[model samples]
Target: MADFLGTDANPSLDGILYPSVQGSEGKLNVVLFHKAARVQALDIPKGAEISADLYVETEDGLEIDYSVWEEVPPESPSATSNRDPLDAREPEDYNGRVPTLRLNISSLRVHRVNHIMFHTESHTVRRHRFEKRGAEF
Candidate 1:
């Protein structure tokens, strides 16, 4: 997936940074990414904690209101997986994978939204193969 802010044609005026989750029924879906070699794996441990603050930004690129955000953390096993199901590969069938942390926010009030900002923090263990790169190798 492209960087939420980087891909915007006119980031200043056009406020929607990421495509809103359709059929979400008033829920916000967030995917977290980490920079690593293609073959590397991510390992988040059980009971790991992830938190984020959501903000609604104004047209002038200033934060306006604090959006009420609640996170439904991914299942422990799903969170610890080496590969994210949403990750796309080069060959379409390649084993190449990227680790992603998914969070679902419920009960957010959005109005005249220009852009959304997320401040996130995670407490988890991330592991990768030393020699070859990923857990699979």
Candidate 2:
């Protein structure tokens, strides 16, 4: 649980890499990851039947178990009072909230921020290139 939004960090990127996320490869660097791709719809793009063996048998990456990029550490109350919630190994980012079921509401809502100027064409990208597949789930 310490990938810290590396999405299972250790595909190796101590710097920068923009590879074409082939398989079993992910990364992280905050920026709210678009509120975890609008609550795990991954911003809705893979509609070609999701059949990479049923997306690796029901893909449950949970965007690396709920990306919490609250400006790299933006929760207060002295960071939620130094938790002790029965001390069963604590590492929580309930940013993707359920909260004991108060109608199961998720959180994170940052509106209004659009200042852009983007261009990256290193031959159209390919950075942390990993191509060692065949786990087959």
Candidate 3:
């Protein structure tokens, strides 16, 4: 299989770092990489949980493997909220308004913008493998 999303194209980015994550609970980037294949980078955030799927091509074009990572907070007292449970992030003041967690999938789709549905897990990190197919089975 020829992996695309996780492969690092830039030398500056270097090798895949274990844990493959950065920043704190409120804000962070999930990074995946492979040294070969000259593929573009795939950097994702919590919002990617719903927006897209990450895939790697196989020797047979008929098949492709995919994975997804969802963002979740640890059991932190500070993370508890008083507002609506559906609210994705903590409220904050900005321009006399509050800020929220708007779903963003920019870095994850730098290579292309094809509609995809990645996998998910109860924990923050999730990885899966699937064959690209004709039907949603």
Candidate 4:
């Protein structure tokens, strides 16, 4: 069972890495696709463009996951000069050794954000199935 959209504190994703964008305060939504998968597209920010289906490839030791996201203070020891600021194009992956997010001046801002809804294996369907992204499993 996935988190769907609610903020699930998945400890397994504590140390996984992800490209951190600058001032990207918008909450990230992970939409998983399966035969029983469903989609709920909500909250289209002003003048935001919908991008392609994001494919996060993971294999071997390092994998893609999410943790109970926390904001890192700028003066903290872990959030020191040792780390680099992240931009959209030149974003940085900070969840390497620990969960960290560093803010800095950049041309990027939080663009479009959508509340993703997911469906898991169940006897009956709950929501509208996202057929395009769905697959047999």
User: lDDT scores for all predictions?
Assistant: 0.48, 0.38, 0.43, 0.38
Each candidate structure's TM-score, on Cα atoms with residue i matched to residue i, is 0.15, 0.14, 0.19, 0.17
What would the per-residue lDDT of candidate 4 be over residues 1-137, giving only the tens digit for each residue?
Answer: 34432234443322222343433446444433232232333434334444432234566545433222233334544433443356433335222232133334244244456664444466975787554776679
Report RMSD for candidate 3: 24.8
Predicted candidate 1 versus true structure: per-residue lDDT over 48-105, tens digit per residue: 5655556566687767565433345566545645886777766856753453323333
Worst 10 residues of 1 by lDDT: 33-42
- Model 4, position 87, has a per-residue lDDT of 41
Best by lDDT: 1
> Which runs in model 1 stand beyond 4 Å of their true positions?
1-64, 68-70, 84-137
lDDT of 2 at 59: 60
In model 4, the Cα lDDT at residue 67 comes to 26
Candidate 2 per-residue C-alpha lDDT over 24-50 given as tens digits, one digit per residue, 9 for 90 to 100: 337434232222333422322222223
TM-score of 1: 0.15
Reference-based TM-score, model 3: 0.19
Model 2 compared with the native: what TM-score?
A: 0.14
The number of the candidate with the highest TM-score is: 3
